[model samples]
Target: MAARETTNARTLTIALAQYAQLELSDPSAFDHFCQSVRSICEASARDGKKIDLLAFPEMHLFGTGTAGEDEANQAQLDAAVDIPQSNGGETEFIADSLPARCAELAKELGIWLIPGTFCERNPEGGIYNTAAVFSPSGELSGSYRKICPWRPYERYTPGDSFTVIDIPGKGRLGLTVCYDAWFPELSRQVAWLGADIIVNLVRTTTPDRRQELVLARATAITNQVFVASVNAAAPQGVGQSLLVDPEGEILHDSEGSDEELLIDTIDLDAVSRVRRIGTAGSNRLWEQFRPDDPEIPLPLYEGHIKPLRWQPQQH
Candidate 1:
């Protein structure tokens, strides 16, 4: 039998794929990878643990095809695919494309899927590191392009907006890619948009991954939302993927730089609980701001944090 769909909105089982990058240069290699994902879902089903959502690391689709950084960058550029823009209109996916394949996989496994970040070629010019979300029924739920690409190393064009998708049984999920987590504003804006869970896709081979774990916990605590940060395995990445609860507690961690599947069932209602009572029943950050509060000037971005507009919708 296929994996069962999540019926309860209060809780959700998620699978984080912490695997090494593969040279998916051809269709057969890509199919093999897809099959591996299917096998995992099937195994979970046999164990009576159906995963509601499965997420992979950033650039999981783009493997290091060459030895040098420049060559690897060029390989990603060469393998970049086109994604249709959703400008308040019906967004279509090209048949047999990476996104379409991911949709098919999601439908096949009967679960939500995030097949990691894809190198997307823009119609006008340049490329973006993008992540696509697919629902169980093979529909393109949403997609998020990386807003903050690692400077001086990554050549991706930054995305201008944040993306949040509402899962029927699960709560609203926000998307962030790699270095985007470094910027707290991104997570704050996403949380302000009514996201109960924030998913951060990362592919950091550098030692800075240690700091990312801290950021993940901080993001969850400040936003009062669950945070799932998935990273690539060692050699390709630092492989310290983790899940942080709304209370800023690390529920699960991959531990070291090894390929492993980190599975956990999270209480979605924990978001509402934390936001309602405050983290540890002490600091009510969200409730602290009032309607009469003054707007704080942000000279760096040439903007102000208006209290009136800063009120996030209660989950």
Candidate 2:
């Protein structure tokens, strides 16, 4: 006989993990981070809801700091993680190693995880910002290196691919790093590839936080997909991680810049519906989730766009 799906099973209970200011560099730091994640998952399970996906901030493994270009870049390179090879042969069995012990914790806690972003060292003496997803069985489900680096200061090479992972029984998952959210075309690319949920791991400075927040919502609204974003806490960023629904409504919002977890159960089925607000949401029109026509390409200048620069000292 086949098993039946439960009501709560269809809904994904996602945990947005903010850094408790934890940075992973060695086995002990990795172990502690996983321990904290285990605690959260265990507690959430006790509430009769299981956390299907747990996402960390973009720089949770590197922490926050102010250092010279060389020192800063070197710090990230030193923290870069890789998969271990065995038997002194090129035939690889397991590709990932510890210190960023995501596979270990996922297997131990029996939950899926995205270990956020870290600096990835290329064999030819370059580094790229990378992130990964692990299955409950401790297998590498998907891996992504950021295509756009934060420029001169970041000192990382850009990856040349897109990664959208398939989660069985759930929906396709897409990964995007901090600056990647600024590009609407990037979101469109991921959505066109059948991503139901796009997870953005972000770290922003205080000055540009408001603008970044707006971009986060804009990405979800434009693509009509669920976005679960995790921003670094406190000194790294504002810690205002947001979970936006397809309709561009805020489902879960974190107000403080501190270590915390925002857990919410969202209905993925709603991704296919066009929301119509009636009487302040008292009535809703459920139209087919058809995307906007591509006939009128976005490149065409529309008057609806805001001015990018200040007018020349007005007349």
Candidate 3:
């Protein structure tokens, strides 16, 4: 992959599509979905505000509406695609896979796009819920597999790592799938890896979505980074896709289970300001540790949190 030119701009415009899933029975239906996405991008451009990044909810690609639970699961598994492992470098995706279509769309629209999660067939065996990120130039920037699959019900192989992508002129972004937000450690580690914003893709249909909202805000506030959590609309999901700022303020929220587009332009510099001055000029959580502070041992992870390593990467 060629290097992207850097810019000093610290602001980015994002569009979150709270989509309502439909019964897609064939490849033509999937094509229609992609066309609909194209229309959204075109409409935004016509309105004189080109979006820097556009995202959809998790499982956006596995919409088997009206199908039985068993049928839906089978369909997802059948449609599962292989995504190349980055291994800390640029990844080349299969030309005919769903990710390739997404990359083409991103390149055509000249916008960063996250078309949401896909069911992935792991080479070693088992299936995994994965999210792919595409750059404006059509590069397969990175992919993140869900580390925590909602247990018992979701029979997916959990991934062991977190992923963060640098978006050239924009800012660094961390990718997280649905249930991953429930674990604060995942978000913390992503933030510590220098993510300016965390993008959480979700497809939640249960009452727990209410609790997820609280987690979204808490994640933003605690990490002092922008949080963009997009969820599927009902009858497929519980909607309520939202964008939270570094101060944990809701910049844009759907609030209901209806299909809608949430658009916002956020100042990424606020992350630095919040971390430097403090959240509300009172809680400087990032700077709380003293120079001689002792490392705190974590028995659960069998590791220690060094005070020196507690601080997030500086932009």
Q: What C-alpha RMSD separates each model from the true structure?
A: 4.2, 9.1, 4.4
TM-score winner between candidates 1 and 2: 1
Please, what is the whole-model Cα lDDT of each candidate in the order they appear? 0.85, 0.71, 0.86
Model 2: runs farther than 4 Å from truth?
Answer: 1-9, 24-27, 64-66, 83-96, 275-315
lDDT of 3: 0.86
Please give the clash total of every predicted structure, in order.
0, 1, 0
Tell me the tens digit of each residue's lDDT in model 1 across 183-290.
999999999999989999999989798899999999998888899999999778889999999888998999798999999988787777677676787777778778
Per-prediction TM-score to the true structure, in the order listed: 0.93, 0.79, 0.93
- Which run of 10 residues does model 3 get worst, by summed lDDT? 1-10
**Residue 223 of model 1: what lDDT?**
87
What's the best-to-worst order under lDDT?
3, 1, 2
Write the residue-wise lDDT of candidate 2 on 1-315 in tens digits.
012233544467789987745553354666677677888988999998899889998867675365667876777777766643222223232334542356767878787888777676788887778887877776677778887777655777898888788777777788889888877767767776767789998876566767777887787776667898888888667888889887677889888788789999877655543333321243232232224422332354442222322111110
